[model samples]
Target: MQRSKVILNSPKIAIGSRADKYWSENGFLDYSKFIRPNLDLPKSLSYGSNPDLLRTKFGIAEIGFGNWVTNEDRFNYVNGLIISLYDLNKLMNIDYFLGLGLLSVSFGARGAGSALAHYESQTKIINVTRYHRGDESKLARFVATGGMGSFAHEYGHFLDYVGGEYVSPHPQVFALTGGRSVSRSRMPCNDRQRLRVITNDLLEKIIWKVPNKTPSAYYTRLAKFMMANGIESDYLIRRNELFARWFEAWVSLKLRSMNIQNKLLSQAKYSPLIYPTENEVREVDKIFQDFMKEFKSGYFIG
Candidate 1:
């Protein structure tokens, strides 16, 4: 049979039936069609048959996702998340899910998995630690799924610094002050392509540019939220963190799987400090929704 053509960079890549069939057949390991230069594929490896073999979804990342998952369910969940994001429209906006260069999963909290998750902008990698190995307690699964949530959050950071433009490390709305056209000449662009088109300003219009002696409405709101909740962490108030938290919330709300949602909700309720408040997510939703409408009006103009 002819291998399915995976248009990995397109935002709509995950949509339509062709991609569906491709993922169902585990067609991503066909590295010949997807491999980047200077990298290698281990010869004669089978998908889903051997647990130790590195699994690489070439269209998603240049490297392989291997030896990271310590157990079956966690491994399956990660695969489900990947296939869901790129093939089922199960979790996030395809562009957002594709923000990271690769999701480098690690098991246990002993070594590289110490941190919950972090995104390296230069490498465009999401290093997520999933400590849930085997049939652990429900609490363990909750924490592990929360680790998965961190994976989504770090991708938010990738979206923030993706363009490598001036005055960055903040949420950027595309097409304001064009320092460089980081965007592609394509419609329904992927995260990488969209970053190029977005403005380099650190959310000048969205959170900054406040009037009457206040510099940012978002800061003010976040401050009050922190105060009201009796949360005294300087980390939560950072601009990039705010946007990522909101992005995670947006992803959580958009998730189609109730099972995943329930797991995440349990973790979130148990440890709510890291995620954003409902109003903050809703506020961003309104702001971004309006921004999208305005952005599309001139999307085709030369």
Candidate 2:
């Protein structure tokens, strides 16, 4: 079968559809305003500004969802969530679902299974849950303090799916391991081709902007910190840790070429735009100093 043609700019939608019903239920009033009659694909041309992947046929649908409370209902609830989240209008099962929400499968903390992106092939869903349902106050605290970092981290995974590299620690990162729980699923031809075009380009630029340190090397450092602090699952580090450091490192470098840096900073509000704390800014400056030394000594290389 021929792949669906890529739509340049995402179209605005007319009301009255499953999306309307879902948005109305979820109270996503702001996002609801953008749904269109046909699939609103962001144009590939506009993606030229994006250094990473170009815009493709695959659509980005972010929904806030959760799972049932206990083990007995976990599987069923997750399945139901996939069904609820799937775009049913795609005439036949050609569409894929990439869920970015919460999962309360176990009785413990909220973000427990957030480390992995759950895939239910039967439903063509790729579930990526990061945050948990902590106390309202705690949730607010996370947002005010470090939620942006978390968002940017997981969002990077979605970018990876479209075409970006996983950039995370290799085997240590289980999301793409060859284990039963982690494997790549194929999308339809049209979706795959178009999505690849857009994502690959954007990701190329995103990755190019980063320093040459491998994720495993950085995670290894994180492991030492965990052991020093007597932490368990020290193997498990928050995704934002990498983003925070990367953001700082990148900004520090850009700070050198003022005009170029300003142009890039202007777009922060749109993509992974972050406002680091004063301390974060200071720390980034320190890293920048280290980066400069390495560059001068000719020991560090991109």
Candidate 3:
């Protein structure tokens, strides 16, 4: 009856599985592989929980939804939503969501795409289409429908907004825990330059400039794809988008959600670029791990 504990209590699809375990367990999903849709799965990801209630760090904006959908459907969306928020939160080690005080999501927003995030007053709102044709309203489908990176991408934009206006720390935001990531002698990302370093270092070093470099060949690949499709390369290859996408790939690595990686390919507009090849993912894994060892703490991400 309670959906809140599904993540902790169920073995269905553990959202927190590390990369190796998730792939080893075959948590990567493909709809074609699923002929029989289990309607009840979404039920477990439904009501009886609120992700904002789960934060051990600072505060998370309590989500408010538009009144155009059934409670079951709303809960389904939230259930899936929190799984992701929590996944990112584990790695945050800092209060990343401190800037925004409230968040609202819309189910029946007019002329809306599958999902989008924007600001209204001080609160941030994510607009997700309530129902689509043949609606895969189930938890996994609902989250992956827009693309795995969608939530992280939009949230990244929200972070840009929050961080842009936020010149300093919130009173409620406590100091960074676990003490430093060694090589992090640099300032506390005032320009909020955490992922930017990855942009210049990790991605730019290996992926962007290098030609046909597997795993890290994000820039070259995106350039080709954008050029071939006639879509402006700038659409996705922007500074802000880059920062957000780094978070997406980081999520892919952290949660080992192959579903996200596959969805990245499926969701072209979203940067599959950030989704590194396993070898590259493995490489970045070591790079970040080593970097953290040297990082002397601070909210690079938080």
Candidate 4:
């Protein structure tokens, strides 16, 4: 008999609902809740004729979540989201793994979901933060502000991992993607050493100037700015860095036009760093306006 294929469906859990439930009793995002439905409710997810194939193929481990930001169990946090092609092969099933992880880390000043994936051994972490509806200040801001595209884009990474179509979009991603394809090899990323160095250096300055604020807090503001400019996935999206640069300019233009300053507690908007260079800034503004006009006229990302 052909083995049954278990296609993991996209799981949804209410905010704070896992407070005392199963793996979420004490807090720190649990992946079981959202992942369970896709594993158990095969028909709802449309996993094809064989559901059991998921277990055998690719070493599939169906996962879900509850408050993932607190940094609880790294292993469990990661284990809760793997779907194996090897296991699926054994079961003769071809099912897609739907990771309902942080669907919306598009808000918040810090790279929440991105950080989680960065620290994890697994390559398939999905950010489902977009699909959720909530009243939490930052989250709500994220919703109202839009640009969950980062999460959606990150999901593409998860899909790539499960398919074993690994490619290093940057040198840093080489470890995760195995540097197998041209597309992956050409990807960009934060300068690993430089990022830490900058973070530490910047933190020192912030500490001396404003002892009340934390570096993480600063990063949060930066994240917001980056997100608004659509440069949050700077290294992920490709095309000679030109598109990325142009895209960022567009975002900067939007934020400037809206006058939405990035305000992290205790951090001052150093006038020099805050929108200096009218010429450079205007260039970005022009690109953004042109892009929007073109977009509205039925063009890219339209």
Point to the candidate with the largest lDDT.
Answer: 3
**TM-score, prediction 4:** 0.25
lDDT of 1 by residue, 112-177 (tens): 434566665555565554445468764455345435446556655654554333222224433232
lDDT by residue (1-302, candidate 2, tens digit) is 11111211223222355644554466423221111112232342221111111112223232222332232122222222222223221211223322222111111123334343332222223343332455675323222221222222332333233221222212332221112221112211233333333322222222232433332333444556667767775223433233333543444334334322221111232222223333434534544344233322221121
Judged by lDDT relative to the true structure, which candidate is superior, 2 or 3?
A: 3
Provide backbone clash counts, one per model.
5, 17, 14, 40
For residue 298, model 3's alpha carbon misses the true position, in angstroms, by 4.9
Off by over 4 Å in 3: 1-47, 51-58, 95-123, 135-149, 164-203, 210-216, 257-274, 286-302
For all candidates in order, the CA lDDT equals: 0.40, 0.28, 0.41, 0.30
- Candidate 4 per-residue lDDT, tens place, 132-245, comes to 345665333332232222322243233333322221133344322332321322233454422222222322332223444443332344446667666655442232222322
Q: Rank the candidates by TM-score, best first.
A: 3, 1, 2, 4
Better of 3 and 4 by TM-score: 3
> Model 1: residues >4 Å from true position, as ranges?
1-58, 62-74, 87-114, 132-146, 165-233, 256-275, 289-302
